[model samples]
Target: MKIAIHQMNSGIDPAVNRAAMDIAIRSASNQGAHFYFAPEMSLLLDRNRERGRIHIQHESTNRHIAALCDTAREAHIWVHVGSVPVLSEDGSGRFANRTLLIDPAGQIVARYDKMHLFDVDLATGESWRESNAYAGGTHPVLAQSPLGPLGLTICYDMRFPDLYSRLAKAGARAFAMPAAFTVPTGKAHWHVLLRARAIESAAFVIAAAQSGGHEDGRETYGHSLVIDPWGEILLDMGDGEGLGFVEINLSRVDEVRAQVPVHLNRRVIPPLD
Candidate 1:
């Protein structure tokens, strides 16, 4: 299966972001890609934290996500609309970072709310407390695809290996991590962490990332990539905006698992206090 990973630089304007995504999707479709993945916050990137809350509440019916579904239907392909800010049911005015999977028929097959919150103080004199603005999810999400069972994850979830391990144990053959990663952290940990996850699970890893600078003046380390079961990066897009694509052979999963069999060689261990 050919998968296209889009390195997108989304801004505060929904119209501009949607237009850019459409062009990228059309290009990928023309190249015969069966699956397309977009970066986190693919629709709008609001710098003003206070306004984000209002925007999420009013823009519950995301035009960009709907477009992705329509594009998938037109191209007869599967599309993962990375992560978008969605309003919760309560009128308490909080949002959830959610990922939506659209099938070829333009129907939503699965939706995953990001479980991990990115609350940290960066060395660049920037601090973020996502929990203050967004609600955390409590469930793990796994979706079925033509390729195989796919485990869903968002940006900060990459730091938690237990989540990935549980998904692998649940028979996930492929994993997707769509992120709007900061340049400093991504440059230091992105490749290593992604490859480590693939090596540990022996599953194909697909990462679609935010590239370049956003309207909010935030810079991201773009290198969107697809890693094979053997931990080899099949495709990589370094910096700037572009698409990285590769033909992934699902059979390689069995071969890699057979070689290591780490999933089968597990031992019950006690947790540290």
Candidate 2:
């Protein structure tokens, strides 16, 4: 399938971010892509909680999401909206970093809340407490796409192999990992971890990432990548803000699995002695 990945340097305004997404989706469809993928926080990337709260509303009332669905319908392309912050349905006054998969007909096919929250203090003094504002999702999501079953995950979720294993066992052939990675971590672990995930699952890994400096005073490492089942880099949009396209052969999943047979041979091990 032909896919378009939109690498972005999103700012603090929700309206501006929504407009960028609209253009990218329409352009992707016009360029003959069947599916369009975007980075995390595609709609809003504001770090100011006070300001962000003004725009973060319940999914039912989020006008930006509604506009995106219409864009997908008008463009006639499937959309993997990396992740957006939405008010949690539970009245905890917290938000959920959610991924929405929209079909060509503009219907939501699946929704995945980011299960693993990022809470860390880096040596670079980049401390992030995701759980402070957002709640974690309880389940992993597997949704059917034109390319096959697609596994949905957000930024920090990439570090957990167990999630990918579960998705693969459940018949996911490709994984969408949308991220807004800090420069330090991205420089050290991004490519390696993504390649590892693809190799271990023997599945395709499509990662569209936020790049460069942002209006919120944060800089991100931008290399958006598309890795095949064998861990081959198909397309790498290096540290820039734009769209990257790639065509993937679904049959490669079976080819690699047949050669290695890791999926079939996997065993349920007892608690490590």
Candidate 3:
């Protein structure tokens, strides 16, 4: 299926981001794309926790999500609202970095919360304590789609191999890794880790990324990538805010798995002291 990946530099405004998404969805649909995708925090990218909290909406009433759903129905195309910040499930005032998959009918087919939070102290003197404002998800989800069984993850989840391995073993043929990766880590590990995930799982890896500087003083390394099962980088939207399109061939998944037999080559290891 044809997929459109959007690389954006979103800020604190949901309206602005949704407007950008609207244009991308229509243009992508015109390009014969069956699905449209965006990066994590496509609606909000502020560093201020309280401001984000004030602006974030509950899942039932998020205007950004409503707009995207409407666009999906109108365009008759599927969309992965890469992810949006929402009120935490426990009513703790924190938020959930959640991804939603919408069908052409504008119905939400699946939702996955980001399992890993970006709590790190970068060598570049940049620090983040994502857990302060967001709660991590407890479960991994694989959503069924026309293309294949798609494994959903957001941002920091890409750094964990076990998550992807579990999903692939559960019959996922493709993985979506929507991210607003910080500049330092993105430059050091983004491509390598994504390629490794695709190679290890023998599945397609589609990562929609946020690019450039934001009003919150955060800079994301934008290189929205689409890697084939063979670990070939099919498309890379190199450090720019724009829309990228690629038609993924599902047959390649079977072809590569047959060749690699990744799931069958398992050897259990014991915990070390």
Top TM-score: which candidate number?
Answer: 2
Q: Sort the candidates on TM-score, descending order.
A: 2, 3, 1
Task: Enumerate residue pairs that collide in model 2.
Answer: none
lDDT of 1 at 109: 94
**Global local distance difference test of model 3:** 0.91
Task: Report the lDDT of model 1 for residue 229.
Answer: 86
Q: Rate the local accuracy (lDDT) of all candidates.
A: 0.87, 0.95, 0.91
Query: Which regions of candidate 2 deviate over 4 angstroms?
Result: none
Clashes of each: 0, 0, 0
Pairs clashing within candidate 3 = none
Superposed Cα deviation of residue 134, candidate 2 (Å): 0.4
TM-score, structure 2 vs. true: 0.99
Weakest 10 consecutive residues of candidate 1 by summed lDDT: 51-60
lDDT per residue as tens, model 2, 1-273: 899999999998889999999999999999999999999998999888888899999998999999999999999999999999999998899999999999999999999999999999999988899999999999999999997999999989999999999999999999999999999999999999999999999999999999999998999999999999999999989978999999989999999999999999999989978
Measured with C-alpha atoms, the lDDT of residue 133 in candidate 3 is 79
Q: lDDT score of model 2?
A: 0.95
